[model samples]
Target: MRFTLRQLEYFIAAGETGSITHASERINISQPSISTAISQLEQELDTQLFIRHHAQGLSLTPAGRIMLMEAKRLVEQAESLYAAASEASEEVRGQLNVGCLTTLAPMVLPELSISFMSAFPRASIRPHADHQEMLLNGLHRAMIDVAITYDLQIPADIEFTPLVDLPVHAIVGESHPLARHSAVTLSELAELPLILLDLPLSAEYFTALFMKEGLSPNIAFRFSQPDIIRTMVANGYGYSLANVTPRSDTALDGRKVVRVRLSGENRPMTIGFATLKQLKKSRLLAAFATHAKSFISDAYIPGMVAPAMGQKKR
Candidate 1:
């Protein structure tokens, strides 16, 4: 082929975004570089790939659309070749794109990533944090190599390896009546005003706990962010439920909150790694998986308090 892979990559990015400026921003390159690469690629292929509009950006011609698909496949194959070479050489070195659950990102990623990179100096990590659905989509689109998330609605194409079980806990302000209790049941909480962390599948998981026991939570407020829910709960807006217990029993604003274990048969969320089932595990990915297993367990989890002693895994 007359065109280099870097040129093809720039062409693909430009074609996908339909704008040289947007493509440059997406890939962190200069606009002139992207435009030059795409122009070079078109010349090598002997075809006009894009229809340029004044101030409107670029649009893919029919030929450009077809070429884009092949370019993506070629890029994937090249990555696979690199992975195979790394495996044969027994070297854990490459850019491993990691997706993480938004709620868990702040607590888990920084420590785990730092330690892993420290161990394998040649390996680098690119982290992306979002909701579970988006994380799964990223895996399908080949945008992320692996995800750190809960075992929630996992499709057959994705594989999950559980590291630890995080049991549900009721978070209440220090001045709340139930704050002093060692453990509280859902029945006791069902009638109280509840501040729910309402993020896609996560909301369903929390509300299901109430539904399973023939109870409905008095959801007085709902927020997508966990920290917001914590702050609201600390301000006595309402009590909330969570599985990941932060080490600090305080809100972002420095107000005290207490995490009380939820009594009865409540389902615990399993924290683990999710990867595409059909994709071959690269050496770097395998190494990161091994590191994750050792770093997170029932006895210890980064940025969160260990599960309560004698807490049975359900």
Candidate 2:
């Protein structure tokens, strides 16, 4: 039988306080009404819940203990409902779930989040890191408001905005022979074992550079995290070739790693925000996307230009 929450609450209050009189006072109900509610609950369950005495207060029977557990759970469920309702009422104060591809999240996301917080102080931005396909799936399911990812020619159902093309740099350990030089040619790095960020965009972008020069890359290691790649490079395990160099404190160990220019084949990765096309962009999402794009441009998009709306990057 479906039980109402009100009946469960009345039963619990009477059991806990050990006095129908006190339960009624706390509940702001008359003593008889509290007694009737408890009696009706017992009758519905066909169970004895209260052990009573004329001179002493009431105590719970075994059945009462079982009912008490259910009562507490019902109360908690009701409270959860209230909390959800309250959160739903506050505009720009609910949860904002977002997704970021492995490559873009590490570079400019920390600063972008800080700016978002300053602008929308109430909303909680929960960030999920994933590959491109997973991020796109989250957008379709409405699991994420927006996604920060590499620019791909995604489906028409999915909306993409090319915020900026980040200027990429070729980096190597300070101890590396090429680190002493201001720039290196694609042919020079071809013979060297290189650490590549095991991302499709990075792989496609950089490998094309080698292909253009009619040279193949000796890709020795493939890792997703830039920090891990930097560590590998720093320890002399291998050298890394990426579009964006470590620009933050967590990036490149100055003592061991240095970034140099690739004169002819330096490839820039296109990074931007993605969301479902039909989903009306919320003010918060629009604001975040705008700020996030600008932040990346200001910090990383050197010697590059932002294309007009509806225009693809060159």
Candidate 3:
């Protein structure tokens, strides 16, 4: 079956946006054109790519999911080839699909993204913010070139390079008693109600901290978004644990939150890049890794505190 690159681009836009209309708007093409491209691609492949819903957006079938992954890789590769051909400079020129952890997106990604884009003006960088599981899935499926995230439960097929160690901080409301303290202990925090950040691997990390002290936190509320958890903690709902610390103490809702150091031998989470193990490192990927390391060393990324000047835990 012969499928044009234009068809794959339209299909990918629709699959990513989950709607033909949105894809049309995103790509500045007519809805009918996008629809026709999708239909032709599906007919060529002789398989259904999407489950159409009347009045609602479309959903990818199992085959559609597989196709989307391959389509993204192909589209990106084609773009890279075009970009390289258009520019004959010494600098590397290609597209990189980067992923960042949802919690770290606001704190760590923007500056690095801008710097990378600026350094390699000929190349394109597409960034996606998601949780660890989704980021890992994207990496496995070749949808994401490299990911900026914590050293979570990395599969054997993935490679992780640690850049900085972020120790967990205990967050509480300004009015809370523990807020005035410079540091708090797990056992001390265990007595208070906990507002858990119940993300896939993060929840386990926070819980394990308490378990090390032979105590279980009295979980009062649980949230997935870090900002929501911060807002709840600022509203005096309960104390929370987090590795990423915003530069400002104020929450999104204009409430004040305090960050206190955790007293004890709590293992710090390593922030790093994750990529497929056997995948060849493209020039774009190598450049990104090098710049990321330099950025951490230069202390240029805002809201991300530098690793403490002490012996790190192995």
Which of the numbered candidates is closest to the native, going by highest TM-score? 3
lDDT tens readout by residue for model 2, 126-220: 67677777788889987677888877547779988877665556677777788788778888888888898776555776788889888999999
Which of candidates 1 and 2 is the stronger one according to lDDT?
1
Off by over 4 Å in 2: 1-91, 248-255, 265-267, 299-314
Best by lDDT: 1
* Model 1: per-residue Cα lDDT at residue 265: 93
Residue-by-residue lDDT tens digits, candidate 3, 166-280? 8888999999999889788998888799999998899999999988888989999889988898899999999999888666789999999988889999998888899999988
TM-score of every candidate relative to the true structure? 0.79, 0.62, 0.82
Candidate 3, residue 12: the lDDT equals 94
Sliding window of 10 residues with minimal summed lDDT for model 3: 305-314
lDDT of 1: 0.90
lDDT by residue for model 1 (1-314), tens: 78888898899889888999888876678999998998888888998999999999999999999999999899878877777778889988877889999999989988999999999997878777889999999999988999999999999999999999998889999999999998999999999999999898999999999999999999999999999999999999999999887778889999999888799998989999999999888889999999999999988888987785435432
Better of 1 and 3 by lDDT: 1
Question: All predictions: root-mean-square deviation over Cα?
Answer: 4.5, 14.7, 4.7
| Decreasing lDDT order of the candidates | 1, 3, 2
Q: Extract clashing residue pairs from model 1.
A: none
TM value for model 1: 0.79
Clashes of each: 0, 2, 0
